[model samples]
Target: MGELVYGLLGRKLGHSWSVPIHTALGCAGYRLIELEPEELPAFLAREDIGGLNVTIPYKMDVMPLCDKIDDRAAAIGSVNTIVRRDGKLLAFNTDADGFCFMARRAGVDFHGGKVLVLGSGGASRTAVACARQLGAREVVVISRSGPDNYENLSRHADADIVVNTTPVGMYPGNGAAPVDLTAFPRCRGVLDVIYNPHRTALLLQAQALGIPCSDGLAMLVAQAKAAEEHFFSRSIPDGETERILSALRHETENIVLIGMPGCGKSTIGAALAALTGREAVDIDAEIERRAGCPIPEIFARGGETEFRALERQATAEAGKRTGCILLTGGGAVKTPENYGALRQNGRIYHLLREVGTLPTDGRPLSQGADLAAMWRERKPLYERFRDTVIDNNGPAEETAQAIWRDFCAYSGD
Candidate 1:
């Protein structure tokens, strides 16, 4: 009926990638319905809805309206996907399968192992249920004031797997972690359900510790795939998830430009932003603003260590943002800690330019230093860290357009 309508039901529909995700799967009619609590009943009562995905503040609310509930959704106490089948709406918990997919992607097997989950909300339920389904021996549901809360978190040092269903490090509040992964030395894997920044501080820490870790992006895509299957009544190739995932990850993630000073990061970043309609940020400028002094003056007054501290702070601030073209200082990659901040929500592009041609007039390190030696030292790091390389030997606009074209191609925007 009525061309089969489908959409996402949420209180705040901003910053959702669901529509584009569904579009990628060849579903062109998806809409995002932002409904107040009172609005949900009438909306669910409508028979024309082909399917709907439930988000925060309404996942549990949509359950009672369903004619039938999937066992996993009932067990999880949440309904994230609703399909109107034969005029009767049936509820299902795709999050359960989604979390399972996330864990499996992280190489975390739940075969009678200790599992610690942060937050006892709707998302946590699926994580707990899925962990149990996969044969997790002990599933500790941590809450704010619960018995296994973050306060007494250290007591659970035996935790084999840690899952963060909390919003601790989700966007705006980036760089903050709920608990220290080092506390649980036995932790073999870590997972955070916050997909905005893609990689949370917890996941970064887990990665630093060489523990297998994954963010909520995989789960987000996997759940969307499951919902698509229910709506279209078709079996999708398992490999489809990965192709969509890679495209989404590259597109949704910010595009960061890293190179030596005067290698055209700022120029190319601004040009790229102009071409793509995305914002552009200069990390060196951000550092100077935070430090209340010129970058050259900061280097002169406080030494390179002081400048690095300010750079790290600025880098973390930039990490919280998404879809911006970030132009970072050449030496930003020297400090390994900055990698997490830069990579949390972006992909690095090494702006390769000839050392002799790079500007050095106002740059402190580049002005009198052996530019050749500096390039030789940072060259490998730039090459190793970059997801793509932008050769800035040509005109700035041309280089920027090249990057814009590639980004649009990868993201399909």
Candidate 2:
């Protein structure tokens, strides 16, 4: 039927390895395209492109762009893969199914387990759908914003599995978790969508207390494989799934360092990279590289508003990398766009230290500020955003070792 035209469109194209990986799978006709939101409609009009994969910023937007959405996609309210059937756009969500496949592969039997889910976003919806479909007894959602606010969680809590779909515990810092697991009695398993840090803080803490946990990598690969099936009109062989997953393993689990300025995000990130045998990326450094100037210069030229816009762009670009440690700016969570990207794309960690531990002139934000008051105000926010909290009150080596222990336990590796 002529060469099948398969492609993907998104703003930041740097972190994507879908092209090489998909091509390696023998879908040579597929083409990956990077385009802005404004360019999507025009791109979809092309008869040459048979199907498409949508990522970030556009997963939800593409819903209206489609002629029809599958039931699962309709229920979850998000779409990541689309197929053109008879000149009509057919939308489907592989995320929930992908997560279910991974859970089964990991030997997770949620049939009778009590479940807890963190956050109430797109991923959480998929997780809920999957859990309910699997016959979980109950599923509860926890958020810093309050239970009443997250109606999805309220409807599902008595589940056997606990899933985290929020950005808490992702790299750049370590502190806070989406749900207060302490409140729940016990769960059969903990599932975290944050894969970057390999074993997120939530997973680590759960493991530390002797709970079984799994990261989002398996689900990501499973969904990616499912998407491949849609693009090729055939099932992906089991052997190839293992091969691609193995390649992705080392690439997806890098340390993500986040905290206030001078909290050693960049320095510690480099060291962590060296020790972990993964590449390190400094979001600020990359922004400087792209902006052709230092961060201070960017701020001076465009003000905080402009700098934040640049930060969001940097976060989006960082989200596409297969495996790498990322060090983000102190205020990366201040913007909803950046926060959403972090929630969807990586593990978040918040580096914390007592006011007495500060070096006086080290951090820009620490200047002329009340340590206790600042901590009080920002602690909850950090807790709200992070999957785990690590006390930077100790040596960096000790901190890294603690992080490693948490990862091994959480990932069950």
Candidate 3:
């Protein structure tokens, strides 16, 4: 027999991490299928498919195709998973179960507490349902044109809990927040249903305010576990969710490379990108592109202070983008201000290589400069920021491969 084929159905799937979630549950052969509205009908008619998970605009559209939907799915008014049982297509909403799991895991007791829900989309519907199920005192659904929208958000200033189900803080829109958490002084906990950034801007704000906060990663993993139970006809260990979450956390955290001048950060970044299938970005190159000048010219005319200013701006921008292999400049760790932003979304790794073997072609700091003195000056800063050390005394390929293996081990990929 062939392997069981299960997949998530959506229009755009570039940002999905469902495959890893399912695989983490010991289920394999998961696929992601992007279908147009017209393509969905034909695809649904095919019974050969093992299981189909729904997303976005198709969640409601799939109701007619289901033979039956249980009370949980009926109450949520959305179906996220479809499985065949007794020759009938059964639709289920694992999202509801997932939200419950997430709430429990977060130690949030919504009972008799006013809840503020952001957005009025499909995710909002499910979150509202979950909140009500938790016996919330009142549930406020905020939409763009709704009476309780962001414009009139002051109406719910006394809310006890906030749940963001919108895509405002999702990847590519990382720095955006639907509403400021400070508006609700009574807010006890915050949840943003955005898993990509792991630590979203909203969550970060809540954390900064000493409020309990969590990202949608738990809900995602919980929902996948629920779907996996349906797919394989088994219940996964409760501890499995956290195990998977820990892995996903590592996977989403950026693999940041910081090192001395000509320590092969750019080369190692490219190799790591290839080995891990994650995008690699050279911060200095991005800085140069934005400044419209080479590092040498920037130093010659604008001096190191001006160059550091541009570097800081670039680093701040790059820190907001998740899942990238960031190759930072040699002096990236010298400033303490850069550490908080960089650590927000990345795991810093210091690439250490012998000073004699280091090249000095385009780097202004290394040209005619004492390599020993530079390393001596920057070693403490590098040690301060790095989550791990990457020794590149061997071949660049060897160092890259070693980093890749260690990254996977750390991330449980």
Candidate 4:
């Protein structure tokens, strides 16, 4: 028959590179399908769909819908990969294998290493099992909700390799690190499975200690490759896989600047572009170019609805341009379509500043306006779209440098 038709079903598990990574494998007809809980069964019933990768909330729920469970998946009590054979659903756990592969590839010596797992969830369990299988001398699970007998030791003193499977240091909360590395002495390695932030607080702390660390990007690529193998019943070319992963990493870590009018979306965006050698696109300028009028005039003549429509179009167009810093209008998040489009190919950074910090004559929109009320109203929307929040109350040049540094760190540039 034709190449197997495979895809994934799950919620929008923020900033996942699953789509690009999977598509890069060149697995013939493989695709990723973002599905709501109610839409899965009907989608699965399709004849052309050969298999699927299930993530997050649907991982456990999908088990009941499977016709058979691989022994390892049953033992692990989770499913991440599924293949359809003779109209029967077979569940498998590629996550464990993926983790093991990544650890080894990263030169982490698991044999006799003292492993510390930072969570007790399904992913943590998989990590613990992988560590043990790789010959870890001891595996300790550390979490506030861990077992009663769990001994929480400082990473500074005890662990050889610390793996964070929890979502603490993930995007939107990139500043919240998982463990205090101050306690752990001379860690050999660290790994965090949250890939969106690429370089998490835990990884940064480890790097600061001169320890070799890795983010979830490699694991994600490995696991996606494994899923592709199952879905296609064939192996993917190694070079193609690497190229796709490189592209995905570059795209996902891109800085997306959002804020209200007079918030320096264009100025700061250009600064960031100059600092990083990346192209910068201002949505409003693009809108103005297309509409042949200024944004305020567009809003005044056609009202907010028409302006939002233009914003959606601008955001969608911006997503198609790679390696560029995108500056969105302050109200872009008000349109789900625009927000979704922006997030499709980039990470969002909310450039925030207190109302009192903004100069009165900054922009046309801020003219004769209630600055405090406007800032307050737009704060929540900006927060919602931000993967990281950078305060713009300081010097623009310094802020640009900081943003550039964080971008380079996040992109592993």
Candidate 5:
């Protein structure tokens, strides 16, 4: 009855977006409560717990602690949303509802289809239950040691839908996929519960295969919306999910620009920053700042290899940042490792300009280098790295604005 404590409960929550999400939904001061296994008991016993959404290791842990459990959560054997009223704790599994919403939004039909869920944890449980409820003819839970494990994924080649509930391709381990999506040629839909990277390796593979795929951001936001409704004892219009989703997408997804040397990446990046009020991070400038000298000095100090090493480091650091304009040097796409670094949180745009029109000032590789040959060599790399291509032959501001329009319209659904 006293001041209510409202937030997400988990073990490690250093990079959670829950606070911003709940705040945007008008849940002022909603915070993250990181606690160890030993501390969970005492924290749950507190008299002031108005509501809390659980995650990871504690989703199942807190179920027994609750005084009452919703039938859906009890049926799923997972409880992620908890509310305290009349000094009694009641738990629910809003994850199921959230998952269903995400799938439906992505046009993933569960009716009369086989669903292959790629984990055995709480999330996997919820996914399985929802898939069944949504009319999935069969649901297979795949775990490491289970009979239907990774070793025998070919058995599920007929799976109509694939849902990843594991953290394999989650942030920090960006490109890891639990299973090769190619194994399931009949997979009509793919959903990953890992939202940080925007696109996971599995989802990316699905995209490449021309399968309908969706990232987990919609699920994350929808789950938060359900949790907020439980917290406030009020209903929120479902449209709010899409609204918050768009805002969060634009705010968290990085706008990365990659191009040949002096193709107006820096200029267009600055223009984008001005129009959007976001910071423009030049990888070249960051390398210079970190090395306490210019890029040419770094190249002079060592060679192209040293400069590339430094570029990799810079790309890695900049890729981790949320909601910024990242301008990469010309040679950034040359490094294969930089793709995962940039794709983790960015929508990369390849800025294309006439090779003859590019300014080669102070560029190590571009200084009297065969510009045509360089473009021919690097064109495939740029094409591989980019989500979209923008022609930079016009004014920088116009190109930036055109990119802004496309980026705004790109709903990674």
Candidate 6:
């Protein structure tokens, strides 16, 4: 046999967090394996195969290939984890355990709650099985062409819990909710299996309505932990799941700064990047780079409308990046579309400085503009966009340190 291989198998995995999650769980050999449909059989027949965690498009395809499948996996009709021992492939479904862990961590009580699972894929099956296992009173699967479909969502308006298994709001397609939570007056909790954005549109709406919600990171980590146990035939402490999740969030989440044009966002962003060892991206600067001109020049060329278009493009590109410090132009928040662009991979912090202290050197709108009036007009936007507010009234480094402290301590809750 050649060297044993262990990794995650998927069709497309550019955004997967499984590598880091498994590595944190002590699997040094863990990696991501992107395979086409035809490559599946040949890869599985390899003699050096050790263990693997399967993902979308392959979860059900590998079942018939497995020599034996645990009852749980058999019941769910899906297998996301496989262990190759004695020349036989053993299959198991760890996603069920992961779904349960995610719900419990978010305090989403499935006991007696009617669940509306969104999708008819492998992940949806896992959610349905786990919801039932957690004592869900009734579980309904809503699919595109099913009896209970998106077109007739009002019929399930009394659903107590909404679990999204589809990739509707996944990254690069961010902010597309599968169903409107407001339509479900009785929705007490929301669970989205897309972990990249950290907050799907469904979860955001749930948050707006004061409903409990959780992203899929916990489920991803928990499933990885369960897969690790199966790989090594050993038990891992439950505490390890949260520990790794926290560390991953701290490492991957972006620190975004948004506020008035001259509220020290750039200076504070640089300082925060220095403190946290993350790259600092100024959206205005990026726009200038793309436009090959300065901000004032851009405004001079095509007015506020043109500047905002460039700013929106810059925000979209910058927000797709992970673990960076993003500083936005003051007027960026005025455009409603910029919210999801920056929020896709960031925790926004609004920087506050005295209106009199704000500089207007090359800022077109701020130059001879009514500073106090600007503040009055933009305060609500800042408040609506910020996850936390930091006073830049203090030293830049001190403010940056404060932001670092908060970012580190934030639970992404």
Q: Pick the candidate with the highest TM-score.
A: 6
Q: Give the TM-score of candidate 4.
A: 0.61
Steric clash pairs (candidate 3)? none
Name the runs in model 6 displaced over 4 angstroms.
Answer: none
User: Candidate 6 has what TM-score?
Assistant: 0.97
**Prediction 5 global C-alpha lDDT:** 0.90
Candidate order, lDDT descending: 6, 5, 1, 3, 4, 2
Task: Write down the TM-score of every candidate.
Answer: 0.81, 0.56, 0.76, 0.61, 0.92, 0.97
Task: Please provide, for model 2 over 47-100, each residue's C-alpha lDDT reduced to its tens digit, 9 standing for 90 to 100.
Answer: 666777776657788888899998889988888888887888888898886788
RMSD of every prediction: 4.3, 10.0, 5.3, 10.6, 2.3, 1.4
Write candidate 5's Cα lDDT for 225-274 as tens digits. 99999999999998899899999988888899999998998899889999
Which pairs clash in model 1?
A: none
Off by over 4 Å in 4: 1-5, 27-48, 148-157, 253-413
lDDT of 3 by residue, 1-413 (tens): 35545899999988888988887787677889998999887787776677878888788888888889977888888899998776678899999888888788777789999999998877888999999989999999998997888888888899999999888867666667888888999999888888767667787688778887777888988898888889879978889888888877776788889999888898899888778889998899999999898889999988899999999889878987777899899998887757755766877788988899899998888889999998989888888887789898888789989887777667421
How many backbone overlaps does candidate 5 show? 0
The weakest ten consecutive residues by lDDT in model 5 span 404-413
**Number of backbone collisions per candidate, in order?**
0, 42, 0, 7, 0, 0
Best by lDDT: 6
Q: Model 3: how far is 20 from its true place, Å?
A: 1.6
Each model's C-alpha lDDT?
Answer: 0.86, 0.69, 0.84, 0.74, 0.90, 0.90
Candidate 2 error regions (>4 Å):
1-5, 9-21, 28-39, 141-159, 171-176, 251-412
At residue 267, candidate 1 shows an lDDT of 84
| Native-referenced Cα lDDT, model 3 | 0.84
**Across residues 1-413, which tens digit of lDDT does each residue of candidate 4 receive?**
66556776777754555766776676555556777888778876666668788776677778777789988888877888988878788889889867876787667888888888887776876788888888999998887754621354633266788888888866555446777776677568788888766666677667557877777877878888888888768976656545665666765555788876666677788788778788888888898998999877897899778878887887777764556788887778888656545654466778877766666552555778888888778778777667787878777888888887776556543
Candidate number with the higher TM-score (1 or 5): 5
